[model samples]
Target: MTFPELVVFDLDFTLWDCGGTWCDCLRPPFLKKEGQFFDSDGRHLTLYSDVLAILDDVDDLGLPMALASRTERPDWARELLKLFGIQDRFPYQEIYPGSKVKHLKKISDLSRVPLDKMLFFDDEHRNLADLRPYGVRCQHVASGMSEELFSEGLELFA
Candidate 1:
């Protein structure tokens, strides 16, 4: 299967096991103790077990990645990515509290990849529905991103 020019991901449940909403108090320089991520407020976050492998596969495919998160705590999200040592993987991040469409528009503008050339993954069905109208291939990651879903996306993009 061919790959999309850019692959965009949602931060919350799609990537990590944080609550529906993250703690606003989370600060920079987050620590990864044991197998989980922790913020200054002691809020714990854990990436789903499949995330690393899927990310690695995407990296091997040499696809540019971006983040489209409707998270109010963008700083916390950025810090968490840094702590996980994957911040550099996504050079185009639109982390803010707004519609996913806005995030995708920014990413599309920056990457110069047309909306149809973008593939998005998010846990929320609403996000997928919203993006579909723009011709972006959207995948619903109900239980975090998995190898199967990633493969399916690749095939669809192809």
Candidate 2:
């Protein structure tokens, strides 16, 4: 039943899917329609089906959650997080364009938690690759975030 001190997730295709693509690809002026999120072009934005529950489960575990996204549009990402009503979930967010290694390093410094005690999930292999050398437990998210995938990540961390 061991758990990492912190859990970090990548945005884009990991925590959410922005119309089957990255959020940076979507046009601006994001909107909400009947509780669903969309862009000006009608591209839908949504947290992966299991995202909310997974976040809550992690919170229940008393582990702090953070977001690391190398998206070019940090403002849009933040807006979407607010639109989804999850802007408050992550106390640490590094959404600018850069290596994830830098993001995790900053999170480590901010939380005073070493890299080894953090578990990171990202859809892109290269992103995971960048953090692997720093002793961060990395999970490759194959099809967005799912309960099964999250469970496997916890097992790997343990």
Candidate 3:
């Protein structure tokens, strides 16, 4: 296996704390609960060390990353990215509110990057299964997501 030149991250449960639901991170203001991601000054907050570390490793490798989420609001997604100070890390971040299966295909096609050259880090198995036909590898980020898995993934990208 070889490392890919690009990696795609699923935003909701994968990278951000969304109250245990998909799209909870970037839900529209009208749909979000009070203080969903509010910080001390009432600004929205992102995820934990997961976000920083992921970006750091990707940056060290000089690899391209894509934020692939079912988030409906593009503006909110951009805001969250900026809040994390990682807005410059990603060259292509897309918000796909509809079926992720379709979006994954579209992203790969639009980027002109082969599916085999991309690794998807998502918590959902169904979404990963849907991309199997495209030959894209998926890493399930459960509570056990660890450095071993991370290194193992690097093997695929290599």
Candidate 4:
């Protein structure tokens, strides 16, 4: 398998489902219940079943990873990531409301990885489309992330 210098992911529906909506839509002060995370509104927050394995796959490949979320509440999303115990996985995080092009530019500048050598995944097609001109291999996640999709993204990058 070939590898990109950086593998970027979007939070929201791409990585986790925040009670059937975006993370920003979920009420904050997130809490844990019965080993599961839930928003104050009792909206369940969880990484998709294949998330850990996909992350592990990237780690096993020794590829650097990042997060690019356009959530209105970066703090809330971060809290959930912390609660989910996966925040440390992404050393580079670009969580804010803006074009993913800016996010990828920032990531490229920070990591010194060229845009062409990067792979990005998100639930929204527009997010990926915006990065097309920059040459980043973009994968639109029709649903939550999965090992199969991740493999396909890597293959596309390769």
Candidate 5:
């Protein structure tokens, strides 16, 4: 298999833990320090342990990355990304409240990468199912993006 032209990610559970709640939507902006984010309510939001390593590996492969998040609080998501200093990692982002299909379509159209040539990672099973018809090689990120899953994705698209 050839490597995908683009890789897309889901923001919330796939990247970071939002305390299993929408507390990420709270009023105050997140605090960034020591490589972690603390929400307004002092709830901790952290990237999966393997996130940086995986991202670095993907970047080393010269693959472009994008974000497709159906997060209700788009502002919060953006803020978190910025605080994490990963905002520039994904040049194409769609973080509105909508179906994953719509997000993937927009990313595909914007990046000019065919659905089949794109690899997507999301935490929701429904999202994986929804993207199948679009020909997107979707992977379910159960706990978060892990090295094993990342390798599987690489193999699938390699």
Candidate 6:
């Protein structure tokens, strides 16, 4: 039976269906004032429900799960997770601002898990490309894509 020892996720686009570049709406407020930003559409996005369910299932199965993002707002990110009610599913150290490649490498080293045993899902091609050479299982989804990618990602770790 194939089971992933570690599952990592990229935030922004991969988790939010905000209908455009995830960083676009956030950059101005986030970079400038360290404040929050909600586009004209408001906070109307949600991750695929299956993703949450899968996290829960992975927990039940004793698999590890984490989030990795280049975002700097640790507080707000935690609040967002609270909004989604999945904050406890992840570890605090798993949410950090650095190159995803760096964070993933650190995670692998600290956990003593080989890169090949890790599964990473991101909506950006660049992130996947950078981590690919390290032997991490990486999947990249197109910007503004649909739930199909989430399904495919789950299958990789399933």
lDDT of each: 0.82, 0.92, 0.67, 0.91, 0.84, 0.66
Best by lDDT: 2
Residue 141, candidate 2: Cα error in Å is 0.5
Q: Is candidate 1 or candidate 6 better by lDDT?
A: 1
Candidate 3 residue runs with Cα over 4 Å from true position: 22-44, 144-148
List, residue by residue over 28-101, the lDDT tens digit for candidate 2: 89888898889999998988899999999999999999999999999989988988889999989988999999
Across residues 14-89, which tens digit of lDDT does each residue of candidate 5 receive?
8887777653466566776686678777788888889989889889989999998887878888888877779999
Task: Please identify which of the two predictions, 2 or 6, would achieve the higher TM-score against the true structure.
Answer: 2
Model 1 residue runs over 4 Å out of place are 19-32, 40-43
Cα RMSD, model 4: 0.9
C-alpha lDDT of candidate 5 relative to the true structure: 0.84
TM-score of 5: 0.92
TM-score, each model?
Answer: 0.87, 0.97, 0.75, 0.97, 0.92, 0.73
lDDT of 1 by residue, 51-142 (tens): 88988887898888999988878877777787777888888989988788999999989989999999899988989998999999988887
Model 3, 1-158: lDDT tens digits are 45686788877666765444444443444232353454333334547445677677878887778877777666766666665567777677768576666766677777788777888887778878877777887887774334555666677655
Model 2 error, position 51 (Å): 0.5
Please report how far candidate 4 places residue 40 from its true position, in Å: 1.7
Which of 4 and 6 is ahead in TM-score? 4
Off by over 4 Å in 6: 18-41, 143-151, 154-158
